[model samples]
Target chain A: MGFGGRCFRVQWGPSALRRFRRSGCRTVRLSTVRDSTPGQRRVPRPVDDGDVPSVVALSEGRRHNGRVANQSGGVTHMTLTAVGVDRPGIVAALAAVLEDLGCNLEDSTMSILRGHFAVLLIVAVPDTIGAETVEAALAPAAHRLDLTVAVRPLGELPSLTSNDQTGRSRTVGGAGADLGEGEVYVFSVHGADRPGIVERATRSLLEAGGNILDLSTRLVGPPDAPVYVLHLTVGFPPGSDAAGAADTVRATLGEVGVQVHAEPVEIDVL
Target chain B: MPVRPVLTLPAPVLTCRARPVGSIDDEARALAVDLIDTMKVSPGCVGLAAPQIGVGLRAFVVDVTGHRKAQSCHGTFVLFDPVVDSASDLQPAREGCMSVPDLTGDVRRASQVVVSGIDPQGVRRTLHVDAFEARAVLHEIDHLDGLVFLDRVAGPHAVFPRKVYR
Candidate 1:
């Protein structure tokens, strides 16, 4: 399988499933979106303290066991989510803690909603570091920042397509890959503020064989007839109907928008 | 010039408005060659601003030739103390930077623009460009101004993490 983004790998077995791995080039590539504050990474430094361990450790342990150790090293992946009232330096503060613990910050996203800052991070930590130790390590920063944080060892990776009815959806709902694979597109819907827009619009994209990698919405315009603007980055399987998917989504969102537009995100890696 | 290391986020130099290149001195010429060599060696890299290499100066190199999204390829070129003479037709597109490393954002940029500057040969040139070339030029210019794509993202949700599988 190509490391193209949004390419779907259909699993044939007792239970049918699909996985989303993204890459735009010849090599099998993987990319996760990191939503964080900019320029906070220390001056041109080694990305991981010269350490070379990965989530590959999880492959041998499999599910039903949260603590998996790689024979070469004891590093494994953990999922951490945090949220609290919005404030500056929260990322830097947390980044410092992770660095001190020798944890590698993997995929992540941080966004301010209303007055709250929410972050979902996947980190690789030494297997010796349990969930509680991580929570305790972050306790000081969490308290100082007035944030609520949770860390847990990841079990089996959930199928990328089962968001509607799975725990994976709750933990990392919008933490999907950026569509650099097969075909990438942006589908946006804007109109008077209302409910069910996300549910309805995202449903259509999912139905069109598109994986919703990232999604965000904003309430804009005057207080009266405020506008709700939503943008989605979608990755479709190779050679799939990208334009058709957008048309299907636009048609599905039908007039729920003052304006609805979809276009290919033709990105040149250069 | 050797391929200098790219300075990443939070590097103080990246946010500082670079000094203007008064004239293409030997140092300026070397910086141009370094920028060109660095941009050439990096895969999927189309441009590089002086600040990206930790040089607080107004210089950048861009080469959009052979890119599928490019409409007005400039081949490979460098400009010193460049300035945008005119810019219009703003559109939002996802952008990633070598300095930022781990994220991408939907940045609004002028799809068409007129830019003037001094070439490495110390000769003055004005470029009228559109489409992907315009975007690449604007991106490098922002770096010269000490601004990364994060500073120009559309809104709160326009930023995304760039996941890398090693």
Candidate 2:
């Protein structure tokens, strides 16, 4: 099927934006809120606290790490990923170093992946700072905490969470106006565990003209008959066929013996 | 009545239990009016609690009239120190908040409820609410208790980020 639509295309193709790991990658919700940014509303979640798809435990004292963005006018985004053996004071030490470096923790996710403490941070670094300075600044903390770290700068950080007058939604992957601003929906799929499910399902959704916001897959049940569950948040630009996209996804995943449920994530204002 | 600014998350006032509005006095009446005014200004907002407008009092206004999801419409009414006399028929519903503006969560609330509270006219009224009306009542009451929809989510993925926060 031709992947042609009115949606804007990313420079690095669809796969370049988001990675869907096959075989064994369970999405975990790492809710480590260190400091609450005043007047800013976070993407509120029902925390199973230290448990999610794969249900990994959170490190200690990681308060306000993920949804802690108070910086208003920074256009640069530097994504930092750190992985190392799990231990106490890891998150706290990282947060302190980031704070000390004058780099604002725009967004962060920390979780124990495969028994390792993994942290992915979207930092708002001032123009005066560079990648080397960040990596060097974090070296001390990384060493003390026995962590491996890397940082890369992405161009033009879009305003997330807060709705600008434009209401233009741009994810970290730089899929700006290319992905039309529209209502967000959550698509949950589950079935017997099998290889190529992630690849086929994600590729089919893209072909069906859907913009993926977030996706996480989990494998559960006994090894004899494993059950794979995938939670995907997707959006379609205005005037796109949402129902049709859902049907296409349903059919595509069904071929691989998966059941699908698509629901619009409408937030009723109370 | 003025359309007061609604506070978002991390605001200490939105998390603390509100003080009781013992009587429907002028101050209580004013709080009720502001709640109504604020709710009216925001399109798609069916309910507003006193704490949302920075008033730490147990008061709120709701008007689900003509709302598509509303089955039992309660034109428009304000309550002071509202109390849930009975709530039954638990159901899951997606809810967003003016205080917690950026995300919505699938929260389980009663589909039917009997709530008693004093109105703006200094008269006590017991409301029989169901469907969306009941959800709105419970949501407002949650605000008075310093709780938002985030506190009642069913699971981690139950919450979804809003593309736009009004």
Best by TM-score: 2
What CAPRI-style quality would you assign to candidate 2?
acceptable
Cα lDDT tens digits, model 1, A59-124, are: 121121332222245677789898898765566666557656766565665666677778888876
Clashing pairs in 2: A8-A178, A32-A65, A33-A63, A33-A64, A33-A65, A34-A63, A34-A64, A34-A65, A52-A55
Docking quality level of the chain pair in candidate 1: incorrect
Error of 2 at A39 (Å): 10
Error of 1 at A70 (Å): 17
Query: All candidates: CA RMSD in angstroms?
Result: 14.4, 10.8
Please give the C-alpha DockQ score of model 2: 0.34
Indicate which candidate wins on lDDT: 2
Chain A TM-score relative to the true structure, per candidate: 0.63, 0.65
CA lDDT, every prediction?
A: 0.67, 0.68
Query: Compared with the true structure, what per-residue lDDT tens digits does model 2 show for residues A104-128?
Result: 5655666675567888888766667
